[model samples]
Target: MSAVLASVAGAALNIGTNPLAIAGLVPIVAAGLTFLRYLRFDPEDHPVSVQKLLPEYDFVIIGGGSAGAVVASRLSEIANWTVLLLEAGPDENEVTDVPSLLGYLQLSNMDWMYQTSPPTDSQYCLAMIGDRCNWPRGKVLGGSSVLNAMVYARGNKRDYDAWEAQGNPGWSYKDILPYFRKSEDNRNPYLARTDYHNSGGYLTVQEVPWRTPLAVAFLQAGKELGYDVRDCNGEKQTGFMITQTTMRRGHRCSTAKAFLRPVRHRENLHIALNSQATKIIIDRRTKRALGVKFVRSGRNKVVRAKREVILSAGAIGSPQLLMLSGIGPKEHLESLNIPVISDLKVGYNLQDHVGLGGFTFIIDDPITFTRNRYQSINVVMEYLLREKGPMTSQGVEGLAFVNTKYAPKDGLWPDVQFHFAASSINSDSDQIRKITGMRDSVYNTVYKPLGDAETWSLLPLLLRPKSTGRISLKSSNPFVYPDINPNYFTHKEDILTLIEGIRIGLNVSDTPSFKRFNSRPHKMPFPSCEQYEFDTDEYWECSIRHFTFTIYHPTSTCKMGPENDGDAVVNPRLKIYGLENLRVIDASIMPNIVSGNTNAPVIMIGEKGADLIKEDWLGQHFRKT
Candidate 1:
């Protein structure tokens, strides 16, 4: 065996790699080599074919991100068509493949590292970075999928139904289900036979092997609270279940790895890394998107597209690019001296899942990912060889979706999502200090005391908020980060809804299943809540304001609706209104944010959008013939 193979085998041997174990190593080793080669033999090392040679293409998809990767890969399958994918960052490395290291990736080199503008009118994130929350969008090839905690959640059916009701014709629940199934390769046998899932597809959805005992207790607690143990993403969403992750063979199945990597050998598909798209090449006279202008290695290059220029740069990047190309709100573009092409509301209606980060429960036993025992060399070996153990676990393992009493009585969809995380006490505070750019004084005062305690945290995420925010230009410069204001809790109803969510969670923790482990609320009293009694509604309200941070699901900035809908930027077909041959195919096009983690839904969007594009062009070609 080669030295590298021998070393890997040695780790497996230590764990007693039986015949079955040895067989599993083959694919793992192959994927590793494939990933390594993709990184090492970058297009930059060769001739500038990715740049100069592809000056004109049948299609140009900017951003090799979650949606961008899928669109480019699917479109290039036509074989006759040439596609160019431009990414602003480097390729995905080994670090991004490990699920446990997801937290550290935020604000790292692979992250966009955008921070929301400090709350102007609300104190929702007062304890965070300069009173602003860290907004970590992925800068790597797979985009946020490489950076996100890989929970595979397809939002409730009603979410898409609501979109179709709002004049988007082909976006009803039934309409999108086929696309969701098209991209999913469900590995869990329990879900495989279910009508909601499909196997033999690109994205692998499976239950992680290693799960904390406390997480199991959380599920049990859900049962005791009268909630059924249903597949949260299956027929019903209102129940507790262990989160399904986007992983395969204990490695992250990022869109780049799942969808893009396998198809990299296709000659028609070209990828350019470290190439930042500075502006979309829009024809001012005709308002047609012709191609893109990008900067790579400090040189400006233009690539034209004969067919279409699709923007999959995500919620923040897509809108910023559009406004930079002068295809946004007229007054805003005029302020920056960017002459308007289509006076559309490109950067309005920003929405996100704002999660309450302070609520935690201290348990008696030390059964958590951060406990020292699980961080040993043996555990690492188990993961390297068998694709099992703590390293495979996406940190927040147990998840529950519930409707608060405040939810509309007639509505079947859940309004709140609860994520149960097994933590070695104060993990959030430690993470904030180490990764989220928070101050030591705040960490010491607010989070230090709980460091050694065995704890499990329950974060209540508001799925739908009446309050909306926006992304606006900091300057005319494309590189300058836009001002992100989630404007969390601007509506009093949002805070009231979360207060009910907290009460419901505390009720679940009080259940006999959780009580067996001596689970009780971790009391880190915030000084801001001193006026109210501990555990009371007023106190929890204060706590929510101080501790609420982003669950990172941002959408609807490039709103999708019929042209008559005043706020709509993209039509039902996802084409930018008044602009020919250009489409926005990312989270930004959501008429409203989905009711769960946005990653899975976003991938489905990519799959659905690619089909629409294919249907449109292929039909046209057939007609011409």
Candidate 2:
């Protein structure tokens, strides 16, 4: 039976695993003999009937992700309201289930794995300054939240207040604070004392266990630097602190794991994985959004929406959906022969937080994270046996907030967001790129290793950089990648901001308390950060332009603005301007990118969006939009 099971498993038609590497297809073969059903996000509820409204659903959601999942879960709870979700990738995988491998995202089939069409001359050249533009979006059930590094830092108050100043009413930090509290299930004793985080939320937001030497060293160094070590998400996002993460008892706590999974069994909810929506069906005469047309396993289907079509497909996917449905710039759509339904600038005003890195370090202790192979095996055994120990590390466990501005502090959030990883990974994820290459060509070559042997990185991601990017349609094909120009550092000020982050990293490493732990980076690459001698400030400036990369924080492609704004695509309520019964609820609605990794904020958007949806529905007394 064991041998039979193994053979069946290997026979499964995986998106990437070797077809001929059928070492043990018998497990899958055995499951086939037993006529097994696919594992579902909802496995316990009475079966949802798909017959009554086959052509139309109550709500047709595009992208089964952080926000879409919650939107479906909450909307369906009202009873007898049918909901449909469209995901471009498969739902079940051991890849998404394993927590530690979360950061290794550019792997086989977990990511949409995209890169920008290399920039042209008219748009200004990054090569003239030296930077390659690349982007990644999770093409799977959980969206980017499924593929992102699990750091859960939220942007401080200043960012939200700034958004309100930009005429986005009800979005100021004070105004939106309730929304933050509503989504977080903080378990930390220290964080619980704060009025900021609410106690009874669906998401389990907590700190990762510190198992490696690097974690302790980073904290010691930060304390020595005089930046009051405090929780970054507590009363203030202003102090140096060990960063919190989206982990539940040492495992990744994605939105699917929290709000969506448990509530999926509601009788009205329906999740359609491996489904790609091509267009939003808007009834021209009625002026109401009817539904969406999507493909599933090579079969096309049009699911009507009696309620609304919610787009929670992240920054790129949301705008792409909008533009493909003819809700974007009129001239651009016209050029692509897409008859325009609404000319609302659906894919402009793109914004992302890009990082310019600087690294120095190596292990000296006999206690390196990469010790003996037997030690690693033992750690994995303990983790599988009890779900504890070094195997639980979320890679980067510490962070330092810095006062990089030359002027007096604003009592606002710090200008810089620093990340500390326990074991050194010089490049993005060397391990995942290797696997992705085996399955697909275009997606595999996205990584370029930028690490020093035996060294960990203290990455300083620029959270509030003034630079912004734009998203445009490519030939009107849903399968084609969009022309993403994340004009990194388009504003010269962004250059200075990242330099400050590097300066803060250096200052923290030079502190006395850190000296006690020998936390200073190993001194082999003395006068470090690329040996080309970026010694002068001008040389440093060149180094900055040349070596920066996306921290995978892309947002604002479908930016929200006051209704009449020329460049805005969606309204503050997250509804696409000039389109009825269709709304976008995701990072794409961010008027500006936040100050940290976006996974937590994305989930926060879902939680808040669910409430907004309920509020709107209740205000209208459950009537159709």
Candidate 3:
């Protein structure tokens, strides 16, 4: 009887909606979970805990995140080198491995949950809690890679070429392509056979195993708009395709899983979990970073590094740590009564990918994903048994890169990127709204009314935003979060570019392929923008200010450039100017943010940084592929 009921419930879920499906499969799923619990299937291998810390290591890397994990893993390959990785949070568990639960992880303990400070004169994030945008960075072992949407997008080739053009050597697309390929193990057969992608590497890149029909229509709509359905990561920068994710067999394969777990048994590598790095201990007279000061288990501790102390604490944390260690602007450090070590710009030139949210297209079909329908017991069973279902979907199913009118006329680069989500803001029943820090009033007025209706949305992201922000020290304390002012849309060109992106998104919705499902724009006007006519330029711009969205790609706080560049904190070799034995190996070192998602590019940065270290210390001949 149980087997028969389970089969019927599974069939009902395949059709996307059956109220009784959940009730019927509950018992079967409960029993299956109980049976599985007895098997003790642990997906993650527990790293051996360090009961006592050695006084010194050959290398100490801060923040065991995306880049830190890779650096620690690769450096430990040298048998004689002792490496210590300090992570402020605990390890990732089975729950975090589920791709569909990414939204739920944002405000949870796994995330740093940093919120952007309210702009003094701007209207951005006006509808959010305290008018601040939530900036979620991963605090766990893999850092943001464990918390991100898992999109593995590598930006345009020209983006890196532009970096080399800025007086930085060996950062051009051709020079860095090997590092990108060295870390990627493309699981897609067709993509793997290409010259651009490789087959065997630590990070697994593949298309998500499951997606809604809305993803299919999004690609078709791109073709109807005269765009090619080609690989956006290969050959060209402007096109549409199914998003490739950093997933393996339908589970999130974060940097911790990819680089750290496999090498957990290495005796030279030591990881200190739940350890917060308070400061980089730089010798005041010599200006050399010698070690790290941290607090672990309510006890303050200090560990020295014989060779180098690498900072991979991410965009926000890296700047904050540097500033806390008196490695910031001279005036700011003196104001806090901290002694200045190197008065270089530590947190300027902050950039992120901003997008306009709440652009929903209501569709008549039941193919779009909904929380209640897809989160049923039958769906859980399908995932647990076959590793295939809506649980495998990364929410963002398809992506399209388009060049807006504001972009360069060269036609090879894209200024705006579109993220096609099978589920919209309201489709998850206010889960996304609450996590994004949206106000109750705004949610009730704009999104709540949509209820359980099937809907899809195209989040038009400003790929290369001209507006730059800053990260500053809130106080001398290391535990206090930094003041992040993205200063979004402060530049006039940013708002204009975003508005053009919206117009293009609307055009994509109007394509013939989208019309197959009777898809149409949700034409409700925001209560704040009711004065303007709906769907007009004025109305859309008003909506954009009220519902500004961030794609969580903050970068370039500690920029890399030549010696003459005043804004540069690090040189072309990624070493902090005027300081010795210290380097930053994360997204924070980017001179400019990439054209698309930042996770893959950051992992690539890690690979290149590891090689750079080898070249500096072990000579160029010791560099790995």
Candidate 4:
């Protein structure tokens, strides 16, 4: 029995256990790869033939994105236990390798390619940026991390403490900081090794060493605009500061590069690429999660779970899976002709942070990312030869925080964030983010130059939004995406706060330091904001309601909390309500969204969860029973 448990623990990458357990995994690796019958553990082996399906695993984790990969890698570290990671997308290749094409990956094969259902209100139609805005999710091996700009951040302490207060004990900032530290390999060679961060950790966290002179001037410009220059993720979230990225030297350090690549050697771990999880397998009469059903090469395959089935499928995918599994609102499932297993809040209380576009600016030097036809073999060769200049930059290298004149007054964290990217606003527009548009075409660059001036984007992000949204089912089909309603400006305060940010962006552009770079404020001639007599406070409010796009921060769906949380879908330990032997380890469990980028926090959750599971076993051993 001890040998069996020892083997199980060694297979998990993040599970902290004694050395003996690791040694026990040797045979499982041999048995799994050689012949499954060697150890009679056929359940852990992948099928060599297309006709055979491995019916069971100790753990089956859905979605191999940031959260899923971390959890699956850690859980499988236990020696003999079987683990299967199901991903809907393929691997990250050179397109993801090039930093210049980073923004273009959004709607590509790597992205889930979701969008908001057109609003019910007519004003929303008049308010769009161009056409439908693109929502990019990770479609490849590392999920979104494979394609993200690689901004590494830990949001405000208040955001976590708020979770504990709302019935999620041990989820406060103090409780989770150790996990964040545990996963970071702070590349700053000069930093201390004691408590701030760990050196041997799998995740890479570093600072962009080279910033254009314009970047520094932009920082000073914000300071001149009355915003404090402080660390965006430090003691205060307010003020302007450089963004800490997940890059090493000049390359993007996505999760696939960090955690997944190193651990693929572990024979116990297996990743199924192009495998899309369509639903969780639940015991209808028992009301317990049993396994998962997925599609591989257009064929439906059911994989059973012996111990647990975990959903790391992300905000949109997780809830969608639950609903399809007949574990959602009974009425909604029945309407689609699906038998109900258990009625729980699968898709409810969706929340997201959104902000308006910032003041536009053009560099006087004419040396932005958009220069030189956006594709110069000479430039690419320069980048490959020497890791210097714009090629090393991920465009937006600066960040700042500020208090909106009407934001929350009690905290040190600001309600606003300032993002400084190298490219102009129009360059990152709806047209460019589209995955499969006629990029490199003639009309886009030459014939359709709006206003005949080039402008890069600087965004003022509202950290704490009063706006609330919902995620509902589109149909009974598991393959179909959900209806995402961000309902921006539902709370009038969000619109007011954004308008105030626009005011600040205008102020910063007008500063003398910004004048040196000739970074003047420029707005697209959107008739909605100017025409139809839409200049008053009411018109501005109406425009905001229709014009906003998600900043890619969606959370609070399936939120963890105590009973009657009103918005919660899971317990404090991230266990989905009304279920056993199942857990959710992703942004979906975020009771309230963090104040900064969600990647760091998602990784932290995985770190903490490994300990929680191990600790549970330890506590059981120490019990009087």
Q: Per-residue lDDT for 90-186 in model 3, tens only?
A: 8886667778877777888888989999988567987788889999999999999999989999999999999999989999999888888999899
lDDT of 3 at 201: 96
TM-score of 4: 0.84
Assess every candidate by TM-score.
Answer: 0.92, 0.84, 0.95, 0.84
| Structural RMSD, model 2 | 6.4
How far does residue 24 in candidate 4 sit from its true spot (Å)?
A: 53
For TM-score, candidate 1 versus 2, the one ahead is 1
Q: Model 1: residues >4 Å from true position, as ranges?
A: 1-52, 425-430, 620-625
Candidate 1 lDDT over 413-487, as tens digits, reads: 889999888875454345556565565666676677786778777889999998999999988899899989898
Q: lDDT by residue for model 2 over 119-147, one digit each (tens)?
A: 44322223222224446677877676677
Q: Report the C-alpha lDDT of model 4 over 474-546, residue by residue, as the tens digit.
A: 7988777888876665676777787777667667777898777777654333443545343345554544543
Task: Give candidates' CA RMSD values in order.
Answer: 5.2, 6.4, 3.5, 11.9
What is the Cα-based lDDT of residue 506 in candidate 3? 89
- Write the number of the candidate with greater lDDT, choosing between 2 and 4: 4
Candidates 2 and 3, the one with greater TM-score: 3
